[model samples]
Target: MPGKPNPVARLFWTAAIGCPFGLWYGPPAFAATGLALTLVLMRHLGRPRRFRARVRRIARAHAETLALRRRQESFSDAYGNRIEDGWLRERAYFLDRTVLPQIGPRFADLAESERNRMLAIVEAEAAAVALPEEDEAPGDGIDYERYCAERLARAGWRAHRTPPSGDQGADIVAVRDGLRLIVQCKRLAKPVGNAAVQEAAAALRYWAGDRAAVVSNAGFTPAARRLAAATGVLLLHHDALDDIDLAGAHRS
Candidate 1:
């Protein structure tokens, strides 16, 4: 107001600085004097209402971006949950001998190889159908254990036969292309429980390698799968191994 320039005030300030500089220096110095004058011109042109509106618009845009980011994270978490749950339910249905049609389209949409893998998991659960109790011996658990390890070996892992020796939770200690992997093999006729998962996770710390895995002929329960996922263990069902490519196994 009284302190600074309006348009008329700007012209007056310009004339004041330029007139003094021109009287002392030359008109060329007037150009340098104009710079300081431009500042006064800007103050004269300033409209508080328009400036506040622009600031409000910018703040609204920033808030919208933050909201969008939060929504995206929510969607991501939901998608992950859906995938895990789908896998868990489908696995259980297949093992229970529920018809494929009853299992829904998600299971139907699986590729041929993936379907075979899932079937293998179901087949592993078919312990009642495959091997007899009278035919089984004390160490016969090694056969299924080997089957699990061989499947991993096929899938570019260097799998070893480390049968459960009753000392620790893990059954196999494998290395895939130099990264060490510890795996516990559970040959169960029924669904695996959370206790087995917790035991395997605890044994992971004893592993001298990079990863820990738990494999079961009978698939893991949803709670067990969640625990395995949270702990970074590869929770594999026996059927999952059917998809492994054993010939090109990577063991470094």
Candidate 2:
């Protein structure tokens, strides 16, 4: 009994070997052993909870990253581009691909918390990306864009200003009822030319916009109007702005 350990002691030494026992002795050794065993047991018992939390964090982070990439892509599908709506771009993509369908006719409900959480994410990401400048419509180009955005918003669109430097061709993005329309606004004293319509068509391809348009406060050149008709790009002149329907643009 003095030189050889009992069967129980041998099992205690090895059964849960979390603590270093050889260097410990007396009641202190027993205390250390108990604490070690408690920790090991707690870890084993809480594994599922830890795993769930980790998975949730990873999923949220992944969603955020994808949203950011999408935002960048709007600027010529690269970085360092000028402004277009930062928020609507991200929100619309998720809304179309994920949110709308999941809650529809599934017998499943979108909890209020889930909706709020999504908004929070979109807002935070949008905010992190700085607007080109604090100044509103720094020049003629931006001024026309601002005008177009206001009119579009009044027409029930969720409008976003595309970045100027990296605009893939769209000056403003108008979204309504999950429909995305890319618009190029011309603030020239003369009529907008055919070039405007061509640029808008190219932008539609790059942005995958449902419809494209060239909007002018003045008027569109005859060539521009014809090209728009052929290419299916809407031409919004000052007089026709009143008759244009924002909701209908989404369908086009």
Candidate 3:
């Protein structure tokens, strides 16, 4: 495989081609050949760089395409599972079978190391593609709270739902590894705001818990994130309940 075209080699070829035409057609032909050579050099010199950029664009497109197809398939399944994990798992296979064929011919003359570098670019770009977020939550707020509690229980936490009324802003109370956590569950179409963060922080103090978190199906507002950060409260996606780090949560 060939490496990038050398500048000296390009100049040599330009002269080789132009000299013959110049000899036959005088100074006019020589000047025209020089101009054409300049344009060719300008464009062809960046071929490798342009090719790498093209590879990144193609990789992202292929990744998004695969994610969309997986999401569509998930709609028909009983669980309505998230497609992000599946997309990541199948990324390499999809790239080899679909993405490579479209761009592989261009890399035919690249050195093995250069080819590997290009593949690395493709992998990074594909990995950077954002998968669609899981938007569907349970039917109502109470169910959503219960759902979060159940997920925490499965993750080895001793978790239970608080009473529907007079719970003092805590939807769930979870304990694991000698740390008690107060969680406020919010299931809303819109993003959770600073009020939820405030509520969770207050609940943590009220319950005398070590840590506090606000778990939501929808994302949190910027204000909420800022408030959570200031109050040492965690604003989390529901999926993150599975891997709660008790010691880490207390420190943070």
Regions of model 1 farther than 4 Å from truth: 1-88, 91-139, 163-167, 242-252
Assess candidate 1 and give its TM-score to the true structure: 0.41
Task: List model 1 lDDT by residue over 168-201, tens digit each.
Answer: 7777777766677777777754546777777777
**Order of quality (TM-score):** 3, 2, 1
After superposing candidate 3 on the true structure, give the runs of residues whose Cα lies further than 4 Å from its correct spot: 1-136, 246-252
Q: Find the candidate with the highest TM-score and give its number.
A: 3
Q: Cα deviation of 193 in candidate 1 (Å)?
A: 0.6
- Lowest summed lDDT across 10 adjacent residues in model 1 is found at 69-78
Residue-wise C-alpha lDDT for candidate 2, range 1-252, written one tens digit per residue: 232224455446543563455245556776777776666566555644543343334335446444443343232212444434433444655545555454343212323324555555555544565433322222377777887788778777888999877887899887888878898887654556889889999999988898888875445555876787788898764334434664453211
User: What TM-score goes with each of the models?
Assistant: 0.41, 0.41, 0.52
- 1 versus 2: better TM-score goes to: 2
Give the clash total for candidate 1.
Answer: 4
Tens-place lDDT per residue, model 3, 1-252, is: 354456667778888999899999999989988987887788776767777776677777666655443442222222554424323334555556665577566554542435666557655765566776854558588989888998999899999898888888999999998899999998765657899888899999988999999887656666876787788898776766878765463211
